[model samples]
Target: MGGYGSGRLHDGRVLCMGGPWVSAIAKDDRFVAGWVTHATRWGIVRGRGNSGGMGGLRMSYRRLYVPGATYFFTVVTYDRRPLFSDPVNVQLLREAFRRVKQHHPFTVEAIVVLPDHIHTLWTLPEGDADFSTRWRLIKTYVSRRCAKTYQPPGSASRQQKSERTVWQRRFWEHLIRNQRDFDNHVAYIHNNPVKHGLATTPEAWPHSSIHRSP
Candidate 1:
């Protein structure tokens, strides 16, 4: 029986808690089931009927990965907490992105950070579809630095795993299939702050990358 931080995958590979929960990936990069745990702001949920072991249930969702492509992402804070309402936290988020980008290069096409969520577009380098790992590192960096001040009290299960409540366990990601899709996502990212009534216009949002656009 593996606890929150570690487990064994279907193929008997060791699973490490890089992020909030562990995603068991097979040799072919497919997510398989074994000792799977999913986390929310409230607590961690293990597979049905499995109390303390590393085997049970299956993951129903599949993530799409395309090398050298554009992606749109919507990432939210745990329990929709307004952690980004403070400008300092927004700067911290930027620092995390910068730190991750230095080692794993990616282009930030567009981005907007709101009080509780963020919308952004990114372009991965050729032959690289490992955005998942990049995101894991970024989240880890932010969580390590901001957990004390921004993170709420987590559940016992989460505390056992040493999970931070900074960001949601999962984020919404979309692979951009065409130029039209990229344009639409960029527009959506810029307008999101206004839609949420955080700003009168997109340009009024100081934390967004819109001001840096040509």
Candidate 2:
């Protein structure tokens, strides 16, 4: 069988895996050396040609992947650009969500669109716990249609991953444990604008579900 050779790591470092070959480059030292040492110490044999990279860098501690479970999410824009400050961009985001819902179909229990980010509560359809796909599609759709201006510079890691500065690399997610959890998240969503000094009250935020809510 063929052997795995030096390949590019997530941080753009060359990972040489033949016989104890190490790079002279100092930049590769941090990630490569640590991973190699860990594998050697633990006797972890990784698959050939596998440079472990899950989209972008690891952000979440542990993602709960229970399909059809209710979840709360906080997603922010790139550089906190306040893209949603304009009403048109806000409408574009809403339209993007609407179109995605038409196809993938998820229940938006609560939602609030802030200038720089969004807070939302969504419940997947039964037997379908794939919120990641939904968020990906939504971001893609909005990026294509939304009003975009100058974007901040993305680092070497983010650029290597082909990620955009349009939105933060990752979002914060919480699985609603029970009724209390759900209620608390909904309240948080409603009050986010006020907390950010964008509004005086939840009812004052026009881009929230509070108006439709009881």
Best by TM-score: 1
Clashes of each: 0, 1
Worst 10 residues of 2 by lDDT: 45-54
Q: Among all windows of ten consecutive residues in candidate 1, which has the lowest summed lDDT?
A: 46-55
What digit string (tens of lDDT, one per residue) describes model 1 on residues 124-167?
A: 76566678888899888888888887657646578679988888
Tens digits of per-residue lDDT for model 2, 135-209: 998887777664236356546576566666678766777655444445677688889889889899989999998
lDDT of each: 0.65, 0.65
RMSD of each: 13.5, 17.1
**TM-scores of the models, in the given order?**
0.70, 0.67
Q: Candidate 2 at residue 104, lDDT?
A: 90
